[model samples]
Target: MRTIGVLGALLLFVEFVGAQTLDSAQVSAIDKNFWKTSLPRHELQWGVGCPLLEEFIIYGMGSDDLSGDFDRPHNWFDKEVYRGSRGTTLFNWSFSYLYRVCKFLWVGADVTYIGFYDVYYDKFTHQKAYINSDQLLTFMPKIRFSYLNRKYVTLYSGISCGIGWVIHSEKKEVNVVTNWAFQATAFGVKAGTSWFGFAEVGLGYKGFGVIGLGYHFNRQNRQLFKRNSL
Candidate 1:
């Protein structure tokens, strides 16, 4: 009876050990798969968005001419020239390069361009004044923090601050102004694997809403491509 009891206890211990080993192996496999499908090290993205804030600023500047007579000398003979203005804003275009430094953090740089044109006219005389065409180019270094990271989706928020070069041209006169530029994303979501589509809600230079496509590659593959190209 004692011998039988010892055999039973040994069998139970061996089975328990086997089960633990199997569970550990399965867990390891799952972890490997999870990391394999997550975010990569390098990403390149291009996008277009409406330059809402910039539009407002440009329009405000355009309206300044309507308030007064473009610094014209007031003449008693000059008819009360009612002034008006019109402008058009192009969509903002951006390109970015990002490097993932850790599981939840990324650093990147963005290049953006915004273009618009404004014209002031005399409403009564039906005569047009000078036309102003302006362009804003910005380079910003940015950081992003991922709050939710998954195999096929990621949710994040980011901020960027930098300087912008404003090129203003009117007829033969050209002016360049250096100014502050920034962007703050409240919510951003990206989906897919090597090729992805993303959308963001933000404020500042990038605009209020953005949608774009991106491609991601690992360091080894990138190096291989460089070698093959050479």
Candidate 2:
């Protein structure tokens, strides 16, 4: 009976030790995952988006009243000659650098360029009369709020406001205009780690929809992990 009692005690002791070991292993795994999922401190991104806002402004500026009386009266009955203008927006290119200020906040600056082409044609003849090209460059300070920061996916919204320089060229004349510029991102999603692809739905200089690639820097540090573990 004593031998049997000893055996049972040994069995219980073994089970207890095993449970402790398993618990330790589980805690270690959780710690490792926590470190792995930590956010980076800095990021750089490059993106391209449709220049909807830029195109709208360019069209307004380029669509002047070219439908006045012609330089010379034509044989054809000329009531009021009408000129038609068409505009093509190339794209909005943006590059930005961001610094993580807190767990759910980031601050950054963005540089963006928008290119547009406009052509005016005679309505009756369909002959191209004038060509105008516009280039808009903007520099803005930006702020982002990250709602979800996961290991492989992140969701954020952002806003930026600053000044833009518009260079308008028509024939031999060049004009430079400065104006206020802004972008507001209602939704944004980023997928990946270290290197990632992102998409943003927004308005203003960045366009209505933006997609880009980004790289994270200062992501990992062994010393920091060790300190946190302790």
Report the Cα RMSD per candidate. Answer: 16.7, 18.1
Q: Give the true-structure RMSD of model 2.
A: 18.1
For this target, which candidate reaches the highest lDDT against the unseen true structure?
2
| Cα lDDT tens digits for candidate 1, 33-135 | 4433344778898888778777765445554433465565564344443335545445789888888776556899888888877665555666776576888
Residue by residue across 97-153, what tens digits does model 2's lDDT show? 998886556899999998776666666677776777789999999987766667789
Q: Please name the candidate that would achieve the greatest TM-score relative to the true structure.
A: 1
**In candidate 2, how many Å is residue 97 off?**
1.0
Q: For model 1, what is the alpha-carbon lDDT of residue 11?
A: 49
Compute each candidate's TM-score over C-alphas.
0.69, 0.68
Q: Which stretches of candidate 1 lie over 4 Å from their true place?
A: 1-38, 66-89, 119-130, 221-230
Residue pairs of candidate 1 with colliding backbone atoms? none
lDDT values of the candidates? 0.73, 0.75
